[model samples]
Target: MPRIPLKYMLLPLGMALSACDKGLEEINRNPNASESVSPEFLLSSVLINTAYDYQREAYWEEPASAGRYITLVRNEDNDKFDWGPRGWDSYYARLSANREMMEIAGTMNQPEYIAVGKVLEAFNFAYITDLYGDIPYSEALLSKNEGIVHPRYDRQQDIYPALLNTLKEANNELSLLSRTVDATADPMYKGDALKWRKLANSLRLRMLLRISKNYAPAFSVMQEILNEPLKYPVFENNEDNAEIGYPGDIGVNSWPGGPLANAFAEFDKRKPSKEIVDALAERDDPRMEVWIAPVDDPNGGRMYMDDYVGVPNAIPAPYDYNGGSPHISRLSPMFNSNSHPMLKASLMTYTELCFILAEAVQAGRVTVAGKTAESLYYEAIRSSMRYYNVEGVADIRDYYNLPGVQYDGTREQLITQKWIALFLKGPEGWFDHRRTGFPQFTLGPLAASAVIPKRFIFPDTERAYNEKQYQQALVQFGEDRAGTLMWYLK
Candidate 1:
């Protein structure tokens, strides 16, 4: 399998179907080929690679911590300084590549293969739609096949339900199969069908809660999944985190790694925001010390909240901080020695599961007899402690005192902690912030080309090629305010 790059995620539509748009079209061209090749093989190949890109940004917490990045730019006390591509072009490429596998799966009677394909589609679509508002979904990628030149944008409400349904469909289809088939083609799990099934359920839970704001219907399913663990059992620990490990390619590592490592990062890119550092500092959050190191400001270079924050992304630094900054890279144990990010970013974790469970338990959704939100809260914290390898905090008094470390009676308190706990897990923290309006962040402004960025705009290529649908979708989006929320969010 070819290694995926952090800069460009997926293949384009033109490249997706150089020979034929659909699987059957290829067989139609050469009918005599018994088609010894199975759709599962093709799907395993494409899906695993796609997982690589999604996993990359997640591990480094690059874009999600943009909130931190923005703060860093402004010399604020609570953010960091890292930046990655933030637009629809990359996602469009990735989804295009991913959708081809979906088409291949559709032609076969292989339930397992189809289910797995749908699961991947659901995950990819969720990421795309969450990042950019109205995308080409209901009518996308089938121009030559259906002569449908212009596909309309599907409402996000409709998109969300479909994403969940596909996951459910995957679970239903996979459960019917009694035999264990090897899918070594899938480099991530090596074709373990059971893990795929669990992945589907776990992914379903993720999508279900993602729309907690606009849709009240998910509330029911969220409760249902929590109640019926047997029917919808999900990843319960770090072992079950949906991640893809890089095969130690110097240029292939996710963050601060490989050929790009020594050049792409200047050791100044990974500073910890006082907000995050302080929050952890209060708990004496073990991961903080593990992930960051203090800078040597021989001249008291710059300090605040008893800590230091990096300059904004793309801002030229005077020097590279001597390869020592209170950054994740400082925590060498989490990665192999390379200046770039790791490819093995955890998409979700046991800590996230426990946090959700804690929230559910508190809300009376899990049917716990007497579990209070506070109890669930502690469990969430504890799971985070274990997840980050932060052990033996004999004192909770100090943690309970800090502003960030304290648990206020607001939704912000609950989610902010969980968000910080999920570093390097993807832009989920941003997503949660958008959905819940938690933690009281000030979007303000960043570089001349950037803003708080409420949502990503549709790619220019997509508008050029799929003009009809793009024009129609344009009605919902205004010229300015890329950060504006979409219909579902509105």
Candidate 2:
């Protein structure tokens, strides 16, 4: 009965414990899988996915067609506005990741990540509400925490204010300069808290201007932000634009229609719409060279005032329009490349901010001390030229002097330029068209819908699975069709 070693004495007990149910449960867990993920890890994934998805949506046919920027010559369903119930699965998936990131950041006491998360959340939700009208907001992405599988659809009117408040909260949190964010995790601003703050306020201004028509207080809140510059900073120049560049890593990371990712025919089918091509060509805008390619006349039999020609949207047999593909302008050759400095995924730009401010001033919403609508209008156009890297190629002043390009002090003039500046940025073009009715887009003879669709139909899956809530939501919408106007529009 000599003293036994402690290890040997516990060996039998340890073996017995391992064989028991409690120890077996622990032993069976996967060694490779993580029980938790860091906020930085989630931030990286969220940024990449959000940017990639948004860029693809912006550059692709759907929004571009609706915006009258480009038209598809083949598979022209979207061009015809033959939209069905469009699902928002990808938007919600990104939102779920963002929610998880924000939660983890809160537990870790990282206010900066939480602030960034708020901005991202607002951006995603804004797109949803803007596109589809009433959407699951307050109760969304809460399946794990509260098991709310069938979240109620929040009215667009209600959702807008909440989004504005969220951005305000983010701006306040980001003002705490002491807190830091991982630069590598942030692709848009690279851990620039001030830039994040700018984006929050800038986006707030955008939303406020959007709802100013219906919401009485929107302009007042917008005035408050503009009046307090330091407390609520906004994008001052192109340097502060919230945009992300593609790594051109081929496969998934490359530009959507980049030569490496898509076949030649796929890229060739998307011809610049006559609406945008004529707009650019008329003003001798240098951006046309950056955005549109000159049409090809191999036989030299076609006489053209400008080398560029565009296909009309919503028309039958668009592929054969303007003497087929050979005689119509395709997108600029630079677009076909895997990546270009000029082609980055834009969340928002100072160019857009300039136009927003101009519109606000024109509409008597807010006023700056030394600026007028005309001045901001000119700045907007100049910024667009610089953003497209065409400023050096041609003087902006000359283009501005052109008859139609000059500042006419009309809302139409202001928004039409904003529309041109917003090309391929996101759904902003379509959103603006829906909101302002600028550029006066006309439906073609062969258009499917008589009226320009205001919102997307609710996804069919919601009807199938979330029947009760879905039915309740339909009462507010009246009909689950694209022609139905959302609260914002109403």
Highest lDDT scorer: 2
For candidate 2, write residues 1-490 as lDDT tens digits: 1112223332433343343476775887567755566788777777777777787887884788888888889988888998988898878977887887788788888878888999999999998888898899999888878999999998888999999999999999888659668987787788999999999999999999888889999888988998999999999999999888877766566677887768878888788889999888888889898999988765544444458988887887887776666778889987887778988878899999999999999988789768999999999988999988888665734787889888888998888899888889988888898888888987888888876678888888999888898889888877888888888777
Clash pairs, candidate 2, are none
Query: How does candidate 1 fare on TM-score?
Result: 0.78
Best by TM-score: 2
Give the per-residue lDDT of model 1 (tens digit) for 1-490.
Answer: 4354523332333333456557767555554533333454455445655665665554344453554522222232223222222455555555555565566556654555666777778887888887777677876656556876677887677888888988888877777776433555566666676677778877776676667657777768877776666677677656666766655545554344333444424333344443455555555565665555544443443333244333333333312332324322232333434432233545566667656655555555444335566765666676666655554551444454556555554566788788777765667777776667765554323333343456655666655687777777767654424566775677
Where does candidate 1 have its weakest 10-residue lDDT segment? 69-78
